[model samples]
Target: MSRFKRGAHVDSRAGFRQEKEDCPVPYGLLKAARKSGQLKSIRAVLMYLGSVPHSVWRLNIDTPQEAQQNLSFGAADLTKLLLSSNKLQSLSEDVKLLPSLVVLDIHDNQLSSLPDSIRDLEQLQKLILSHNKLTQLPSGLWRLTNLRCLHLQQNLIEQIPQDSGQLVHLDDLDLSNNHLMDIPESLANLKNLVALNLSCNKLKSLPPAISEMKNLRMLDCSRNQIESIPPVLAQMESLEQLYLRHNKLRFLPELHCCKTLKELHCGNNQIEVLEADHLKHLSALSFLALRDNKVKNLPEEITLLQGLEHLDLTNNDISSLPCGLGTLPKLKSLALEGNPLRTIRRDLLTKGTGELLKYLRSRIQEEPKTAMTLPSQAKINVHAIKTLKTLDYSEMNKTHQDKSMTTNRGCCRKATKMEEILLGESFLSFDLCKYRMLAFIKIKRGLFRFP
Candidate 1:
């Protein structure tokens, strides 16, 4: 007889024994095997029934039936045990008796602790403890070195033991939405770790030793109280996606060596300045965000980011932009909303980024150059009259008074063609006391001289 036992999947009206009109062998099968009979135990009972036709084990057992089992799955035939949502306060110690167990899911239970005998199941590879009231893990949990996936999220846990680093084979660790104040330094010992999430915590800084994780590719430390990112993070050559949003960072640390960084999200911070040298080094950076900060200007050196594809500068105080930013060849999505700049036409807001960039490019290209002409009075008259308009009498008077007082103002005015006027449509604006009389006399052949 096989030592494995499987439970029955039957409704409330399940028949235990067939009444009068049945074959004797079928009647024997309908009867529950007596403890002292051929099936002495549940395992032998399942083995004897294995020869029966059309028998399926119970998989979707409700709370009533599960409670009847009392969270006990001592049957060796049980390779997968799911006791989730059974309203059990704790797991039975008999769980360790199942030596062949491979997957165990007791999530969504009210258990605040685990049986110390859990370590006996050396074959257990996956454990789910999410939605539990566990504040700390079992001390023997690290002994399960075969664990490849562990889900401990949404718990009241406040700290992780330094011994957690013993899980060297762990490739993914999620500790989000907890009350953790800091991460253990032993975490750096997990050199094979590929993804880590530390969001929604109070971590002020990360251990500098984290740079040793050469295989780490995704890191999320957002929604923390971190004030500064250590410059050593820049040396993480394999890092690809870094999320540092919702922190108190005031400036971007020099990331000259993060050559593989592709997506950087640093929004919702106090960053106010971006150094041109720092930007020139991010050759591989594609998606950049500086939203909801106090950034005021974009350096022309940003044009050197040849691979830049998406730039988000929404909700900042940037009043103007460097003209060359529009000519970036690879730029695809550019967000400039909620800024104070009116550099682009006011009506262009509804048109979108492409239209705005094109408008700025057109504006720069069509910018009129102040025409330079001959040094003769004729050209001087046209140039001065066109450039200077509605002269400030008070300013001129103060200048003249200062000249008379300083005694060299007249000498200064004689050296420069102090002022001039020219003919134009429906306007005869002139600075009479200075260039006014000079231009008039020159055109009149010195007819009305001011000597």
Candidate 2:
């Protein structure tokens, strides 16, 4: 009963005729989709390749069937097509008709394979096909040299072709949550890549060549079976944040050259010991997460990270903390929960960082200072030794007086530098008897003279 829509002409045989601007090759695709009952639940909500001018076309296919049956893009060129979350089981090869496409995002679809003709979109720059059922990528995908961001996460993808090195312009590449066993070393050729995500995969180790990605700023290889990281990764000049959580690492590699690294997350591992040499070089580290590990103690060198703001040592075997930990000027959050601390009261830990730090400082102040006693043969200068006022030699054991006098002569006759010491506040003036005794026996040191 309703006359043909705006762009449609009445066709006696095919029932509906599209506008002349529509490509004939893609027109047959619509007819095939209609015949297969693919268009039964979806309205005529598709854009055929038109002229080469209108570049930004977004076909938001997530709408209900009541969506507009026909929408006008005004211009003809189709440069961006976003059909994300569509129930599209297959994409027609006629997609090649849109030669001007620069961004093609069909994420959240059921597409198992892409048409080889996808290579025809030479102008493509950003391609997102994440959350799909794709087991392998098409060879045509690797030839897109202009791509800057390629997201293929949350898919069943098992491998990436070596031809991926051709995307030298990629800045962000997310291949996380896939079945990838390992990455190709050729990925190092992406010298301009800034962020890379390889989480939740079946990878046991990473290619050492990954350290060659000079401009990579973020590298996430979490939730894998990686037992260790390539030591050369510490040489990446631009790397700032590294994530290796939920793995089987027995020890953290010594990152001696990662000067720009700021955040390191290596939780849930078998790391039992944190060596001072391996951790002290992260000079710029601000956030360090060592939770759920077998760590028995934290190295005192960890306090050398003067810029550190947060430290997580949860669920470890640490029984005592380094006293210097409370001296970090910028430390704001210190997490020591679930550790076997024997000295710190559990209630004091719950009192917040300010109170906990106050307690650590109180302990520092309460600690007894070890006295420094000079040996019997050491020389002493009576003038330099400020604490010596009087000493009682009359009460000395008569048997040892000769030995004591001989030892005291050697200790004072050649008076040298005296060690500064804390003196008791018992007396003020030097006793005359002490002066007399010092002049009498050459009991030469003030330490042996008796009052």
Q: In each prediction, how many residue pairs overlap at the backbone (N, C-alpha, C within less than 3 A)?
A: 1, 1
Across residues 1-451, which tens digit of lDDT does each residue of candidate 2 receive?
A: 5696577676676736665455233334333332332222121232333221111212112222223456432223456666676666777777776677777888887788898998988888899999989999889988889899899999999999899999999999999999999899999899999999999999999999999998999999999999988888878988899999999999987787788889999999999999987776787899999999999987767766878998899999999987768777788998889999998889889988878877777775566223223222222243333233233232233332333233333322222222222222211222232332233221323443357
Question: What TM-score, computed on C-alpha atoms, does each candidate reach?
Answer: 0.62, 0.68
lDDT of 1 by residue, 1-451 (tens): 7788777776666587654333133323222221111211232332333221121121122122334767643222445555455455666566665555566776676778787778776776777777778887877777777666677766778988998888888777778767789888888988888888888888899989888788888899999999998888877788888898999999886777778888889999999998876686677889998899889889766776778889999999988876657677678888888999867666786687687677666764565223222211110122223333222222122212322212232222332343433322212132335444343322323323366
Best by TM-score: 2
Candidate 1 residue pairs that clash: 419-435
* Maximum-lDDT candidate: 2
